[model samples]
Target: MDRSSDAPPHPAQALPVPAWQGTWRFTLPPIDSSVPQARHAIRDLLRRRAAPLSAERTHGLMLILSELVTNAVRHAALLTPEIGVEVTVDPHWAWVRVEDGHPYRPHALAASPERQRTGGRGLLLVQATAQEAGGSCGVRATAGGGKVIWAVLPLDRPTGRPATSPPPRSAP
Candidate 1:
């Protein structure tokens, strides 16, 4: 997605222009504190703007943002002293991106039962959460030689159901 409010609306929704329809950006020094700060700020911005996202969607987005910022702090702090965060929402979708000046592009590890570890699975969780919510995520190289990890999700639930409800059951 373009991460701009001007992006086209989803075909099914004819939503009116929301108060939160715009792109917002932030730059923070890569540090442990920046993780929560970034998440909180984004949360507050969305709430203050009265974003149409459901609580579940907002929470999922926050988790993705936290993981991205925490990764940047842990892995890229030395090379990239600053981290960039961006949030954008239109009537149909919401986008979150975290950028750092590291050249390495990390991939989400595949989920498995045998792998026993407490850490190094942030990206995997990010991918799974996004996919479950009918969204997509990936990394892209920035013009400055850095990488931006991003996720884009719909403003409304994709399954035509409430966000907190389970996906419809399949017939036997």
Candidate 2:
């Protein structure tokens, strides 16, 4: 592949005009402390919105963000000192993306069952969580030689079912 400009594999998302387009952007140093702060920022954003997420949904979203950001801080800090986080939402779903300026390369994070307990399965957990909620998660390289990890999750429970409580049992 003839590469010219060092940019992300995916083109940057165009910021919608007026800035009220349900998008949240965050810039934070890739530090351990930023993890919690990032989560809080996202939580506050969701809370301020008109829609309310079930506790399960909120927790799941936080987990996805935490792992993605944590990985950047722990693994990519050598190349990138700052992390960029973005959240875009619609009626049905919220898309979260974490971008860092680390050099772009395939990240080997899978571990064998025996090794899994020791660690290195953050992405696996992230994928599982997103899948459980009928969403998707993935990574992509940026033009700046960094990469972005993203997850798309529903803002509400699946149709005809509740996330937590089962439908009220009908009187027998």
Each candidate: RMSD: 9.8, 14.3
Please give the lDDT score at residue 24 for candidate 1.
96
Per-residue lDDT of model 2, residues 72-133, tens digit only? 88988888878999988654567788999876543446766657366677888887898898
Clash pairs detected, candidate 2? 6-143, 7-142, 7-143, 8-142, 8-143, 9-141
RMSD of 1: 9.8
Model 2 earns a TM-score of: 0.74
Flag regions of model 1 displaced more than 4 Å: 1-17, 157-172
Error of 2 at 47 (Å): 0.6
Index of the highest-TM-score prediction:
1
* Candidate 1 residue lDDT tens string, 43-132: 999999988889999999999999999999999998897899999886566788899999999998875789777788899998888888
Model 2 misplaced regions, further than 4 Å: 1-21, 104-111, 157-172
Q: How many angstroms is residue 144 displaced in model 2 relative to the true structure, after the best TM-score fit?
A: 0.6
